[model samples]
Target: MTSEAPLPKPSFMNALITFGLIVVVISYGLFFLKVNLHSLMLICLMIAGISASLLTRCDFSTIRHAMSEGVSRALGAIFVFILIGVLIAAFIQAGTVSALIYYGLQFLTPSMLLPAGLILCSLMSVATGTSWGTAGTAGVVLVGVGGAMNIPLPLVAGVVVSGACFGDKISPLSDTTILAAISSRTDLYDHIRSMMYTTGPAFLIVLLVFWLLGQQYAGNALPSSQLLLMSNALNNAYIINAWCLLPFLVMLGLSIARVAAEPAMLLSSVIAVLIAVFMQDAEIVNVLTALYSGGGPGQTGVAMLDELLGRGGIAAMMWTLSLGLMALSLGGILYKFGFLQVLITTALRRVTSVFNLVVVTILSVFAGNLTMGEAYLSITLGGQLFSDAYDERGVNRSVLSRSLEEGGTLTAPLIPWTTGGAFMSATLGVNVLDYAPWALLNWLNPLLGMLFAFFGIAIFKPQAAPSANHSTPTDVSFKSVN
Candidate 1:
């Protein structure tokens, strides 16, 4: 906690310089040098640590604690990452994924697939309040289906992400939703309501865009011959039937019932592995091997089917996990050293109106995501950073929370190094940059939010004067951001 153990306060200029230095490195390495995210993040971690030590003059022990605390805070997400890998492999082995593909092709057409997928993913994410789970399970199915239909995988991935994040932004079950509301000291439902005004419109627009674009690409559908080839390969490889769907149904049911994601996913994977061995007539040795390395050689002789099916496992997820760890540790150092704090504080001091406050809130959280390399930290700290400005301007707390989600929650997955981004890339098999252009809902919401703020549409009027005792939060120990 800053109140309990404050580091030497960093100057705004030093903080800005350090953050800029990191941005340059990330841009150069990510875009020009074409370095992998894991290596890029490692470089960043070292740079951040060194900068923090020089600017804040913090002891090595404090730096180590910050690094440890960063990863520790996100332990739940790390566990979920490992489980997602296991679940994907198990689902493929049990014919659950194969069954979906085999059956999905019977109904889904290239012309309507984008809009339909967006709606389905939206419903699932809302029900489960989990974007990652929705992306891992349903998103994977949609990507494979898109490929079978000869639709561009990046476009399909973008639509899937847009829909998955829609529920996460406004759903009551979402951790980011709850975190934003708590941080802003607003009612949970109030935060949700505020979000609906922007999220609803953005979602509809995204649906329309994908629909129109999908129509233009309908001609790209696979020839009937190729489609039949894929269908036959899947049919020959696994016992595709309704029984295969049971594992997914059970996982979805548990998630909607408020069971923890970890337990729900683990239980589902167990069922899937059992079905693979007994019902699918797969060898136990092969099943266990698939559980660790995704899978061995493909069951189907078709190159495309084999390629998609032969992915998942702990080893497959290591690239994402390692990158996320580096980013989190670097974020911990930045947060603890007060680099972000000084910059956000300086920015808040210049806010002069309610509209400015709203726009700043959105941009600050977006910047927080970039500098902190995670949405949780941005959402939590953005609340503390801007609550006073909103209070003084007579803006509703719900607006502040809505801004947090619009910026932090929506933008995190578009960045390549954030935990959200890494998970999406690993699960969906598309680079963030590739799909970012198509994930309209994620970017458009913030624009609409700012537009609404400008015209005063849906912006709540202040009902009372600013609280005299309102002050910066003292609970910013960074331990609770998760």
Candidate 2:
């Protein structure tokens, strides 16, 4: 009798289990120990090292292979991170970033300070498709102005970030928004429209919060004297004009036209660099240097502008890319071992009712964001794990997408170590917690999501009946299993 060959061990199942336990550990660490990203990353790597050593029982080569696989999975995100850095640097060296800031500063006055700050930053974020860029440039200037006016820095920074993130979250040009849609496998326009349900209210609420916050200093006029200083600084630094906005317009148009992100970003960077050469007679060496080092300034007197504009070089992105790789490596190791699937399976079994399913989905989405610390993965994985349950309950695709946005996209910046929070904090020079309380949109989001989930508000269902060909015809459909 031929003996059945022993089944090969299921690595993904084991990885899923490992991932779940690690998630628990990370969540506990964050909540109870208040650990930071460096610590969290180390903890995850150590756990992964131990797991591989014990479970794989493989030689050094095998272990290295597993780690390599994990890191390899991170390559795409790493490239994007580096590209963003290069783009930031190119724009700065190209003088586009500075010109935008100079024009923004031209309108700053204490009378409409908060509203103006919000509007300008929001506009910049929408234009650049990056809240971090907006925060780094215009946001920093607003903070300095607040300091000059003896206003609280954190509060001002919070308002600036609020507006910046709001615009970034909503704008079609935003990479994160694109990532969210792509990962969810939804139409970009559809995703944006669906997001408005949560995003619109959050933005209105945040605007109100800023307006109220600004009331304390409502009568204070912007100091006219500083405007001249700013103008002189801009005049001395680089040629500034409406013409500088062409590259930005091109980028924005490309995004609006639904062009893919990587190519669009690259093309925009090239356009910006070309403009820099023509307008400023920028040396080729400076262009190349800026690509790597966030722009080599010939001689810009405004230190703040220099700092703001001189950001986003390829070299500068290494830190973010490394961190992202570490996170993805840990995620891959967990997947390979069986952590995530196990939790999802177990959770699925336990959630019997629609309310329970909705609650669990919201919680799971939050958990994913918290554990993964990246919005793209959170939305993708969370949508994958929960979509079927929603369908079974006759829930809508929009609801699932809404939940992903609420718990995944909006909550990401609240986690200090999460990619969104880390990028924003690093870019804006504000602590995650410092802005957490003030990120009105972020805070209200999960609650609104959960509310809609439980109340069954705004949840849409497909009109057709289920046929043998369709899994759940009446259920709302998602673009992907994720």
Off by over 4 Å in 1: 1-5, 462-482
Q: Please, what are the lDDT tens digits per residue for candidate 1 over residues 82-126?
A: 999999999989999898888888888899999999999999989
lDDT by residue for model 2 (255-284), tens = 556565467678988998888888878888
All candidates: CA RMSD in angstroms? 3.9, 5.7
lDDT of 1 at 207: 94
Error of 1 at 158 (Å): 0.3
Q: Return the TM-score for each candidate structure.
A: 0.94, 0.78
Window of ten residues with lowest summed lDDT in model 2: 473-482
Those runs of model 2 whose alpha carbons end farther than 4 Å from true positions after fitting are 1-36, 52-74, 108-195, 217-220, 295-303, 465-482
